[model samples]
Structures are given as C-alpha cells and as structure tokens.
Target: MAENGFQGALTYIYDPAILLRLTSFQAEYKNGVTPLNPGETLKLRPLCLEDYDKGYLQLLSQLTSVGDVTREQFEDRFNKMKACDDTYYVTVIEDTTSKQVIGSATLVKEQKFIHRSTARARVEDVVVNDSYRGKQLGKVLVDVLVSLGRELGCYKVSLECKDHNVKFYTIFGFEAGKGQNYMQIRFFD
Candidate 1:
C-alpha cells in the first residue's frame, strides 16, 4: 500500500514487487508507452489554490481544438469541484521552472446507486499546451492520475476523448465499452 506514494513524497517501505515493476517500465521505455520527449522546465507536482485559475485556465484554453471545454466553463467546473463532497480533487502536474501550465490531469469518483456499493472514478480534463503535445505529456499525466484512482479503490478509471483522439487513447489500453451509452447536455442558453 505504501509502495505508491504521493507525488514528490517518498513512500515508507521498499516493496520489492513495485521496485521490480518500475525497473521493468524504465527498461522497456520505448517499446509501447509514449516516449517522454524532454519537456521545458516542467515538474509533476500537486496543484495549489493559486492554480485554480492561472494554470487551470491556461490548460483549459488548449481544449479549443477539442471544442467542448472553455475557459469560463472550466472555472465553473473548478468551483463546483471545490464544493463537492466525495470528490477526489487534484491537479497532478505543473511546469514550475518555466512557469507554464504545460499539462494537467484530474480524477472524479461517483458512488454507485445500486444495492451494491462501489466507487467509479472518471478521469477528466487532461490537457497539454500546443507546445507540449508531441512531447507525450498527456500520457504521463493520465498514467499518474490512473494510479491515484486505483490506489483509492476506484472500480474503474474511465475517460472520454473526441473521436479523433481514438489512436491516442488506444496506445494507452483504453477501449470503447461494447454496449455503453454516452449522453451529454451542453449548457446552451
């Protein structure tokens, strides 16, 4: 349990299996996973109150191509997240040295409404600035968030991207559910 610690914090014990897995990951780096092209002065750190608007908005603007999220909408969502009860909230990436909001990732879990109780985490708002896209920052951000979701007992970590993003998610082992229904209500006035 202590094997996977919070970002920037050291875990207590040396779990051999975890260590071996990490070693194997690094050794097989270029085989399948998105290769981490060197980023400009970036660091993966926990989001802060200061990021609620600055870094958060910067990342949200990059979603212009995705055509669903907007800066104002992101702020509203961020406000809602701040006030939700049972929400696992955190922005798990940052670019400190460059002072740029290069990329970000978040996880939200909802309780099941059935007789059986379970929590399902949905990863959302994975964005990387235009300058950072080809560098594979999105994959790294999602990878970290998925790890957090599993650690917190999430039944599954699911996310949705545009149809054009199929190949990107495919490389990370995500598949369309065989018979799942997807519906959405855009806030149109």
Candidate 2:
C-alpha cells in the first residue's frame, strides 16, 4: 500500500477484493420519502458511525492501497471538519425498506484565502452502492449536498474525482479542470 503522509493523517491498505464487496454487506438504511416509490422506498441521509462496521472497515482499509487517505488521516480530517463547523456535512443514501446504505458524500468548509470571511466547501467521499449504481442516486445525493453548501454561504464548492469519473461530476455542472492530475488526482489516485 502506497500513501503520502500529507499535512494530516491518512491510513489505508491495499486489497481490491474487499472493496468490491462493500455493497454486498448492506444493512437496509432508512429514509423518509413522501408517497414512497412502489418497491423502492429508500431515501438518502448522512451516515453515522453506527452505519459502519467490520465490512466498512474492511473496505476502507483497502482504499489506501495505492496511497490515498489513510484511516488515521481521515479521522484527523473528519475531526478538523467537525471542529471547523457543526454544519460540516457527511451524508449517505439509504434504502429505508432494506435499511442498507447505498451511497455516501461529504461537504467540508475550506479557507480559500487568508482574507476570505467564510470558508468555502469541498465535497468528497461520494460513493454509491455498486448494486444501485445506475439509479442516479449519487447525483441526487450530491445535488442536495451542493444546495446545502450554497445555503451555508459557500462562495465556492469544489470536489475531486478520478479522471475516469469526470463524467459523473460533470452532470452536476462542475467544470472540468484541464491540467496535470487536476482535481486532486494525485491526492487519492
């Protein structure tokens, strides 16, 4: 497992097999949907520690295989986020019926410059359950989170995704950066 000991902490391991199986260890996460879709009653919300377990740990451990955010680094980052603002958001989409978490996303306050008043937001960790990939659930989850950032007075909202995943972010009106590893390509690739 390769990793950059950045300014903060990052913990990770290398194991593709476990990561691919994350969606299989689902736990029916519930959300409120008005006039729920017949047979599709799941909704999206922020994920909590309770939603995590051995499976999440197992897959997350592998995320650092190629040297991305290490576990300890993520924890430090999460703490910084929480300390910066209570509004720092981490959300997840869950199927109310099955109580399984389908997707997860996050928003963090970022300081654009020393002169800025309010910090901007950086969206990250946007992942949808593999089983529910084609439903556009990730889009919905990010849409709401983006709106939330706007409401919070974020002058700028940014997120980094893999080059292969550029298409996914483009749907939400995020401009693509043209350069070497633009958009944190090296951060988590």
Candidate 3:
C-alpha cells in the first residue's frame, strides 16, 4: 500500500483535512482553526502507521492496559481496521513540536438493520495525556468524532464513561439513558 493511500478506499481515513473541516473548532473559527498556543504546534488528524513511534500506544496506555504490543502488531491491527472500509475512525491529536500523540479518540460505526438500515456510531477510548489536561483537547476530540459520525450518516452516537466524567460528556450532548446499562463480559482479567 502507498504511504498516503488505502488499498481500495476512496479516501485516506487519517487525512488531516477531514478534521480541519468536521471539527467544532473549525465551526468556531470560520477562517481556520489555530493551535492551542501561538508558539506551540498542535495537529488533529487520523492515526497513521508511523504513529507507532509517536507514542501512540503509549498514549493509549494512559487510558487502558495496552499490554506490550509490538510495532508489527500495531500495523497489523491498523491494516485490519483500514480493511473495514470506514467503520473505524481513530482520531489523534499530536504535539508536533514534541512529535508525540497528546490525545486520542475513536468512532466505530456499526451497521444496523433496525433503523432503516442506517448505521450508528460508538465513541470509545477517549483520552488525553496528563500533562495536556487543562487544554480543551478533550472537547475537541469529542466534537470531531461526533461530527464525523453525523457525516457518515449515523443515526445516533453513544459512549460510556465513569460517573465522574458524565457531566463533561453532557456538555457534548450525551445523555444518560434512564434504565440503560453498560454490561461487559471480559474474556481476560
């Protein structure tokens, strides 16, 4: 596969231009969205194979146990996701100055037959590095995924978070279902 090309897809899933146009930050800044700091360089884009060295897995470890995944394993998973067409959108925010992934999020689109065969999206693995917590990067990540879900024609998007983070998600229009529960069956402990 080419560096910037997908096997048979029309567009690259990790294209930065997608974020530039779909994020709320762009809506706020009609002209263009600038970095968080005038002197610092920050970029919001989709995950790429080279990200393996950019602390991509290290950043994910901050959210959950990433286990010792090798570079080959990372690329294998990435290739599988890309093969699924547009089902997965793993977005990332990089501190270009430091060449490290600072924050990340994923939108997984699920095809459904109930809602007139329309698809729905699940927002998952949203996290920001400890050192970069104060900035609005989290908000930006959520906004980007939500907007991408809509653009993909998903009927609705949902996510699960701890009780403490409920208030934060609410700001992005996520509401807790009255009697809904998030049950999980872990295969490994």
Candidate 4:
C-alpha cells in the first residue's frame, strides 16, 4: 500500500537496474534501424540528438520568416522530443556525400478515443532546403510519412498547406478543405 503525496498520488521510484536494462535495449533497437531514402542520392533518418545543429539549419530554412529561435529554446524543445519519440516521428533527409540534413518533416500520431481507438497522423513542418528544392524531395518526404502512418496503423493522415500549394499536396492524395477548415488558437507572440 502506497501513501498519496501532496497531490493525492503515490510517488514510486523505479529500479535503476531495470531502467538501465531498458536503456540498453533501446540503444540496441536504434542501432538496427536503417536510414530511409527515396532516391539513391539522399538518405532519411529519424531525428537524433546529434542532429541538433543541422536540424536547426533545416528549421531556419522554413521558419526564418516567422521568428528566430534561441539555442536554449531549441535545446529545451529537443529535450522534450527525446522523451516523446513514440508520438513524434520527425525525419530528416541528408546529403549522402556531405552528410547534411537538407530536408525535414514530422509525422505525429494522435491517439484518440474515437473510431475504435484509431490514431490520426498529422504531418507537419515539411521543409526542404532552398538549394534542394525542385527535385521532388518534398514528394519523397510526404510519401515516406504516409507509409509510416500506415505502418503505425493510423486511421488517416492529414496536413495543412498554403492555398498555392494545394495542388502540390493534392498529388499526394490530400484534398484541400476536407469538409473542415483548419482552426488554431495561438498563444505565442
């Protein structure tokens, strides 16, 4: 029997040995995973801690117009991502020779109670470096994410894009305004 703390919940400390074993297992799993590539030239892999710098570069390519992110803020977000990899599947495309992360996309799965507990995949932050555009890299990224959605047993996948890019995403079987407009309440300045 465990006593409740101030918040009316029990505080249980996990075994260090068990935690270490789990960490070791996760490391083994990560090592066996392969990088994905749509073409022979560029390769894609899940975002890792070592990608902090290059990942920032890829993000700046798309978000420079919106605002600037400080290194501390970026690292804080990265730390949270490290803990939430099960829900957030962010992939980066790399230049094979130079080993540069030239493109990035995120496929986040939202587990819901509706549809018999089916998950919904939201594809976000799809950006290709300016120098790497016009080579159908975006298509490759989206295709890979869609495949990942299926692999994760998601009921459906969706994304929001600019009106001009509606036709672009349509090629990926994404219909514009699928009976619902995207609504958001932003609290950021």
For every candidate in turn, the CA RMSD to the true structure comes to 7.2, 12.5, 4.7, 11.7
What's the TM for model 1?
A: 0.66
Residue-level lDDT tens digits of model 2 in 43-79: 4444443444313433333333423545676566556
Please, what are the lDDT tens digits per residue for candidate 4 over residues 1-189? 222111123111111121112111101112233224345666655654555555545455574454566667766776786566457777767676766778878888899899899899999988888888766677767766776777677899999878898877776677766578788898874
Candidate 1, residues 11-122: lDDT per residue as tens digits? 2111112212321111113324432222445655545444544456656766644345565675566566656755644544456575666776667778876535778888
State the RMSD for candidate 4.
Answer: 11.7
* lDDT for 75 (candidate 1): 55
Measured with C-alpha atoms, the lDDT of residue 174 in candidate 3 is 87
Q: TM-score of predicted model 4?
A: 0.71
Once fitted onto the true fold, the runs of candidate 4 whose alpha carbons sit more than 4 angstroms away are 1-35, 39-41, 64-73
What's the lDDT for residue 46 in model 1? 49
lDDT of 3 by residue, 1-189 (tens): 435322224233555455545534232322234432211477677887788989999999999899999999988889889899878899888887898989989999999998999999999999999998867778778877888888788999999899999988887688999999999999994
Ranking by lDDT: 3, 4, 1, 2
Better of 1 and 4 by lDDT: 4
Q: Report the error of model 1 at residue 100, Å.
A: 2.1
**Which consecutive 10 residues in model 4 have the weakest lDDT in total?**
20-29
Model 2: CA > 4 A from native: 1-39, 53-84, 112-115, 178-189
Model 1 lDDT-worst window of ten: 19-28
